[model samples]
Target: MSARDAPRPRVHVVHAHSEADSFVTAMKNVIVAEFRDTGHQVTVSDLHAKNFNPVASPRDFLERSDASRLVYPLEQRHGYATGTLAADIHEEIEPVLAADLLVFTFPVYWFGAPAILKGWFDRVLLSGVCYGGKRVYGRGGLAGKRAFSAFSLGAKEGMFGADGIHGELVTGMMRHLFQGTMGYVGLDVVQPFGGYNVPYIAQDKREGLLDELRAVVRNLDDRPVLAVPDLDDFSEKLLPLHENPAVS
Candidate 1:
């Protein structure tokens, strides 16, 4: 390829659910095809289909040197797994480091990411490379890239809103995980694209979601930074105070 043809932006689509026929997986396929159709250099990491090792084993932990201990507990376990994952994990991280944008696709289980995707984060986002020490500012390793989720939630939409049992927007609940983890590592989180009530959603609504997802992908090149708040200054700048009952 010529130099002009060689520098296209790379996109990595990480799919975390298990079943091929599952709604989340199907949604991922839709996303991959859309990204490809746009002519971006795309890569896929199908975590469940690839049988990714979700647990950090004892040997994995022991592989760490003393200096690595100060890093995230998960970071110390790199290159410790045997059999297939010895290669799989390495392959997963390659595209991650190379990609200009990453789209995480998964089903929200128990109000959070599926265990496997979380494990991917635990394993792939490490200290020195992704975060820690004097690098608390955006100067950390992951500063320039972008990361965000396009998730399907199984719960009813109303249950995730204010005054409901869950009492928070799903994204707000997850701000710390992405903002603290990926954000710490330097990925600006683009606004997430989500669909709620998956099991009960109608065929038409599902199609509409797909259309919206494609729109998001089509506009990916233009996404804004969407920078997160600093943790120390977070409560002061963002938190809301309680109103007195006697005020009115």
Candidate 2:
């Protein structure tokens, strides 16, 4: 289709940052502005601002399969099948279901995602809804959709390389976030954009990072989706076949 005649994508940004004026928040704002300016619709789930309940407890299910004991995955499957999930969970799922592009923005904490964002995956990406059993990875529920991570870290850029103390950035932190969670759910994940040494960067450099963030947001569709192994690539035992070796 011609560029103008093409359908505009629905972008959903899940922002997880405690401080409203933080670098992570600024990144999210840049994404929103870029997408909106480019004629795409955008929805943001500001987790901290909403005071999202990060804990996945028995309260998540309205009618528990077993009231005496709490088995999270089983309860998640049951709730999804029966439409008995908590109101909050349902609220989170709505935007995701409607989105064509999903983006997660946060500040890396202690070499990992913020606790709240981690909980977001635990709760929002429930069984039988986002993923389950054979319906995972390349065959996941959100297969046709796209997602990405844009995060900032306190550590310097040089520390994330292969020989650096932090190890390879992509295969390290980004892998845990993008490949593990987002890709597992069948969303074609894009390579993450990291704003390294965010806390100590100069204003000029920070502004440059902001510009880069805007560029990424504006060209979301142009980015390549990271390849992930499909269900067919696995043997009956769920192990990878040599022909289509699984990505670590």
Candidate 3:
């Protein structure tokens, strides 16, 4: 079907920031607005506002597979199979299942997502449901869905390059967030929107960043997705048969 004749895409934004006035929040708002203007259905999971629990413990499962031994992944696999996962987890999963596009907006904490957002990945992206066994990489449960990350860093752009103190923002995040989390679950990961030195930048520059973010959101469907290795390229033990090129 032609793009115009297709159904409106369902977009879910998981906004992880304590302060509503933060630059990250503004970036999220820009995304939501742009998507809405383009006729996409949008849903925002405001983690902090909803007081989401970031810690993953026994509370996530209603009935554990083993009463004494608590192996989280096994329990997740069992809970998802049995439909006995916690109410909160089920609540979060609904929006994720309905989404055609998922966007995460947060401020980088120690070169990674904030703890709350990390917890969302831990608790909501369940094993049997989102992935398990052969359901990973390109063959993952959520394959064909698209995802993007919009985040800000405390360090300047220069500090994230090859020879800088932080060393390559995209490369570092590829290991932790993009390839590890989103791509692991089969989402077609899009290039991230990184706002560097957000806290230290001037007012005009920050506003310019917001404008750039709006443009990114508006053109999301046209953007090139990051290339991930197909499952067929791996062996039975899941080792790559050929050398994988660096993401940089």
Candidate 4:
């Protein structure tokens, strides 16, 4: 396809921070705007701003609380409460299914994803569709999709290395969470771009971080990577779907 005729990359950016003024929130806005400027279809799932319901409801129980009747499917009750899941899912899933890239923008809290974003994972990346079913072989339901994460932190960079308080770079900590979990579900992770020391960094340093963030989006791979089976059933491997090294 020609540049204009080529399918524009679709990105589902899930923002997890509660405050708009927070550095992570600001980064989400900037990244969305930049992606849009490049003609990508950007769908922002503002988890907190939407007051997204974090806890799964009765419908998620092994035996759904309500057997009244259903519109989508009986299995959907196992997916999420049709009555209580955030309405945004209706609007979000289409783009998510169509998306070429899925970007999660959030602040790392307690060495993990923010609660709201984690809830999104719990609710949206459901059992039947996103993963786990007779149709799937531990291969993610999102088998062909790609995932990326951009994180912002307020601590000094030195606090994350082998000798630091966390004793791991931000990415190192995210590997299992991102790779083992999300990657296991079929999304190949690109090297994540993280901004550290946000609270103490000077204006120039923050600007530098923004530059790095921009590069991350600009450099996003046009095609997703393929996650295939490894020798063991418990393990899996990923290979870049596209052969062109220049694209990376």
Candidate 5:
């Protein structure tokens, strides 16, 4: 089938903004609209609006394996196998499992994802289902999917670079999210689209930023993909080809 005629992706957007009318939230709306307009199916999980719990604790499991003490990963494993994960976690995972594309929308908080979004990762990306052991990076359980980030920052774009004052926004400040978490889980990472100086930018510029994001969602397939380790370059046991080169 022609590229245009091919089926569009099923998109799952995890939005982290708290304000309903904020520009960051507007960017999320644009993503939903563009995907839907292009014949894609879109689902959204508005973290703050849903009052999603960002804390991961014994409460995450409906029934703990050990009532006396909580071993998080073990409980997560038990939870997935026993269908005991909390209701909200299951609800969020459903869309993540069904989606072809995952979009993260948020305002940068302390050069990282908002606490809630980080909690989503902690609670939703189930250990057994999304990853474990050798199932990480290229071999991760979520390998077939793609992930994109649309974020806004209070600082200017130029301040972020390998040598810039902030020193590498995506690869540095936010690396924990895009790389450590998303890439570690095997999603094909896309170059991020950031709205810089968001708090200080004028109204027209904010609108233009939305327009840029609109085009980004519309042409998501054309966006550059970021680099991550491929299992092919490693051994069957996740070690490097040269005597298990992967850093232990």
Candidate 6:
């Protein structure tokens, strides 16, 4: 069905950028505005502005499973089950849990996402709530959801690729995010939108990128999706269930 004829999505944007006036923020704003204009419900978590605590520590759990020792993942299970996660983490998780589409906005630093955004993956994707034991990949809690990323970087697009100076961006440089984190937890990962050479490029070129980004967001659901693991073809020991089993 066409986007106009389809049901509106619940979009949750996690914006990670230090400067208030940065291009990262602009991309985040544009993505959010486009979704809202299309009658989608949009929720934003501006990490820097909110002073989100990115560090994962014992303090995250208001009531630990083992008060004597701190096991972060174990405690995550406990916290989520008991509704004892820290106020800030819980607040951000609400929108994430409610979202049909999760849009991550940040600038690539050191060929990776900023530390704050990385920390979001660590802290918010609770072991029990999102994934645990056999509940991962295609069987994960968020199996039906989708994730999209819109990031700005200083380098040109040519600098990345299989043989480029920086290698691949989505499946290569940030494979951990695309596959391990997002896809691992069962979100169908979308091929990301990159604002390449923004800092060194001309204003006209930057505007062109923004226009491209807006179109991406407007036609967000139609974007290409990356393949992730499908557990139905795997045994409990993670072996192929069939000789012809496909590995995504």
What TM-score goes with each of the models? 0.79, 0.92, 0.92, 0.76, 0.92, 0.92
Model 6, span 1-248: residue lDDT tens? 98678876799999999897889998888888888887888899999989988899999988877999888999998898899999998998889999998999999888788999999989999998888888888888888999999999988899899889989988888888788899889898988999998999988888899899998877777888998778877878677778745633
Give the range where candidate 3 is weakest over 10 consecutive residues by summed lDDT: 239-248
RMSD of 4: 7.8
**Tens digit of per-residue lDDT, candidate 3, span 17-76:** 989889999999999999998899999999999999988999888999898989998999
User: Which residue pairs in candidate 2 have backbone atoms (N, alpha carbon, C) closer than 3 angstroms, thus clashing?
Assistant: none
Model 1, span 1-248: residue lDDT tens:
88676888788988998889887887888878987887778888888878888765433343444443434343343433322224555677778889988889998876678899888887776555666554543666677888867899877778866676777753467666666667777788787777888889898998888888888877866765556655444332334323333322
The per-prediction tally of clashing pairs is 3, 0, 1, 0, 3, 0
Evaluate all candidate structures by whole-model CA lDDT and list the values in order: 0.71, 0.87, 0.88, 0.69, 0.89, 0.88
Better of 1 and 4 by lDDT: 1
lDDT of 4 by residue, 144-202 (tens): 77788888876677787778877776346665567555776667666666788787878
Where does the lowest 10-residue lDDT sum fall in candidate 6? 239-248
Q: Which stretches of candidate 4 lie over 4 Å from their true place?
A: 59-88, 133-138, 162-165, 222-248
Give me the runs in candidate 3 sitting further than 4 Å from their true place: 1-6, 242-248
Those runs of model 5 whose alpha carbons end farther than 4 Å from true positions after fitting are 1-8, 235-248
Where does candidate 6 stray beyond 4 Å?
1-8, 240-248
Candidate 1: list runs displaced more than 4 Å.
1-6, 61-86, 161-164, 222-225, 230-248
Where is model 2 more than 4 Å wrong at Cα?
Answer: 1-7, 243-248
Collision pairs in model 6: none
- For model 2, residues 50-156, the per-residue Cα lDDT tens digits are 99999999899999998989999999989988989999899998899999989999998877789999999999998887888878888888888989889998988
Of 2 and 3, the candidate ranking higher by lDDT: 3
lDDT of 1 at 190: 81
